[model samples]
Target chain A: MQLFLLILLGIGVLILQSAFPFYLKVAGVKPDLLTAILTLYAFIEGPLPGARLGFIYGLMEDILLGRFLGLNTFCRTLNSYLVGYAGQWLNPENPWAPTLLAFISVWLHYLFLLLPGRLAGFRYPLLPGIVNIIFPTALYTSSLTLILFILLRGGVSWKRGRRKAGE
Target chain B: MFPRRRYSLFLWMLLGGLALFLMGATGWRRDSLGFLEIAFREGLAPVQKVVATVGSRAYGWIEGLKSWRGLQEENRALKRELERLQALNIQLEEHRLENQRLKELLHFAETQGSDFRFVAARVIGRNPTNWYSTLTLDKGERQGIKRGQVVITSKGLVGRVVKVSPNTAEVLLITDRECAVGGLILENRTPGVVEGSPEFKGYLQMIHIPKEAPAEENQRVITSGLGGVFPKGIPIGVIVRIVTEPDGLMKKAIIAPFVDFDRLEEVLVII
Candidate 1:
């Protein structure tokens, strides 16, 4: 039940990301919300939870966007497990760590998405698309991640409090 | 500069990076569509309605202000119109003949035997991306709409349905960067393909017009009928300007589209 709730919650965040008009053109720049959500979950829960969350969230996005199957699935799952492991050393309470980590996560996601498109006989406007996806989303995702991480901490602590009371 | 413990996490991110690399490396990309997606899209209906209600109220208020000033002006105009009607009444028979002559070209669409289910829809959302000049229609599968359906206006052809869901569908507007139309140069008789420019340019470029074609500025451009997407002979736009390559091999012209897409509200979905 918790796992399903986490994945659904992540997808809800992604919808907010897609529905956001961060750019003047509106649809051009979409902040990586699922990436941030996955990152936050991975840091708090560890590797196994992170990977599972990532896989489920990616599948939901695939259904939502009507995208190519297994494409987002692979990228998102891998990032979650890795970020979860890396999250061990960080002070999850520190606002800036989550902020910086989100940039790295989104950047890595962008790079992965770019690689296959270039290799498979697709002509990618390499430098421009990289610049478009990476730099623009970095700052926006950072601020958003910071806020989301704090909210998540509050939720987690509240759950822990309830469990302790039951015991 | 890379943190050592985090270095391992980098490898996982690398796999994700690697997978995206694979997607980009190939020409194939997945585009998803199913009933659940359609339902999810339809789920946006409430949000759109909220925005629309606020917008309609704002528009109504502004229009009310303008109408007050306009009504006085219209009263004066009506006096002159009364005298003009006296003259028009005598020439009514002649005017009716002229109307039939002008409408002869329009008769073809009505006569064509095609199964059509018309759905009236509103423009609910627009692509928040710069590359997209597309709009999302408020009607979808619930209205029996589907991909490849034609969207037109009382004016003329608008575009075709490219993506669909249960209650909503995304329309590839004629003005979008990815949109292209097959058009005939009415004067020169040369057929060409028209696509949008990336300079954040609003106008269209009709490419590969033959040099032998009698091309000139300000000529009318219409659908060539070669592309199966749109019906032939619909008015596209007028040539605002033209240019040629350095070698003068093929010509390209700038076309100003007839419909002002930014202000679009109502459209007819032909299913």
Candidate 2:
């Protein structure tokens, strides 16, 4: 059942990614949907399941972008695992709580990818990108999460109703 | 079975990293990758078609609302420019030399028993989340574009044909991490490799020129055409900053790319 849920999560992510670029085009900005989804799922599931989902998500992205094939996978898996580990200390039940953690984790995820590239004497203008894009993105993503929280609340109740009727 | 999932995750990542390092180190570029690239293009073609169709319809409606006078003026300008190119064709060899010359040669190159003609392709995909600039063009094998063919703009060398499909190609811009152009400092006459500094801010870094090579600020860099991939003397960019090695035996510099990526409406592919 755990593996089944994980697979379902991945399928959901692929559909999201497939549909995301269009949404980005409409909005004129690329929101890191994978990052948002992975962070959210990592908080829901434990680190292990989260890492598995992250790996699958990353592979699909790397395939679609045709980039350094596994780079996205490695980076995303690392980010999701870190977020999952952090979830241990947070109250996922609180509506506002996971939003703060997601905000922090996304920044950490970007930082993890940036460090090795920077250490190689490549100057990544971290401050400006974070200041300009990251904060706005976090607020946007938080608003999105709030909307999602309300939506998912409905979805969870609907699922429970179907399950109880069948049982 | 203790933290078994963690162990597998670590193992998978390690193996995956090894695979990526191998691929990068070997520098494997293939025409078949064009299949993947073209699939992306075709997959997105409908979206672009819809956009272009809607954009043109809206434009046409606006044209009717605005005036026919503006359209007539643009037509006159294009005709005048066309005549000027015909005249320039008679006296060339000095300005836009590389593009004209390449096209002249392309008019003669074999392997296409039918002459390989040039066409301008629309810029579709710009590399997302990238400092290194790459562009995907919407023309491909159906147009007789092949591996190792050079792509250029009116200003100069854009990139080479790394991958091509029946309808599209992904151009590894002169600014890609693995793209190397045989280049020289026109003033100093020193030869070097212009490697894409992916981490560089929308530019390329020409690396490993000898210390004796005096590449100063604003020196014009052009392809030496040492390699058959890019024809010689195509303008690349002007040097912006020079990085010197500790021993001072060699030096390199960053080049501000001449191609205005944002406004890349059309580009002529050299067959």
> By DockQ thresholds, what CAPRI class is model 2?
incorrect
Q: What is the C-alpha RMSD, rounded to one decimal, of candidate 2?
A: 36.7
Q: How does each model score on lDDT?
A: 0.72, 0.71
Interface RMSD of each: 5.0, 6.3
Per-residue lDDT tens digits for candidate 2, residues A23-120, read 44222234565677777788778788778888887787767567567767887888789878888887877656557756776576556555664554
- Work out the TM-score per prediction: 0.54, 0.53
Off by over 4 Å in 1: A14-28, A89-91, A118-124, A150-167, B1-117, B122-146, B153-158, B163-179, B183-192, B195-223, B233-266
Per-residue alpha-carbon lDDT of candidate 2 for residues B213-246, written as tens digits (9 for 90 to 100):
7789999999998977777877898899998865
TM-score of chain B of each: 0.55, 0.55
Clashes of each: 28, 0
- Candidate DockQ scores, in order: 0.04, 0.02
Query: Global CA lDDT of candidate 2, please?
Result: 0.71
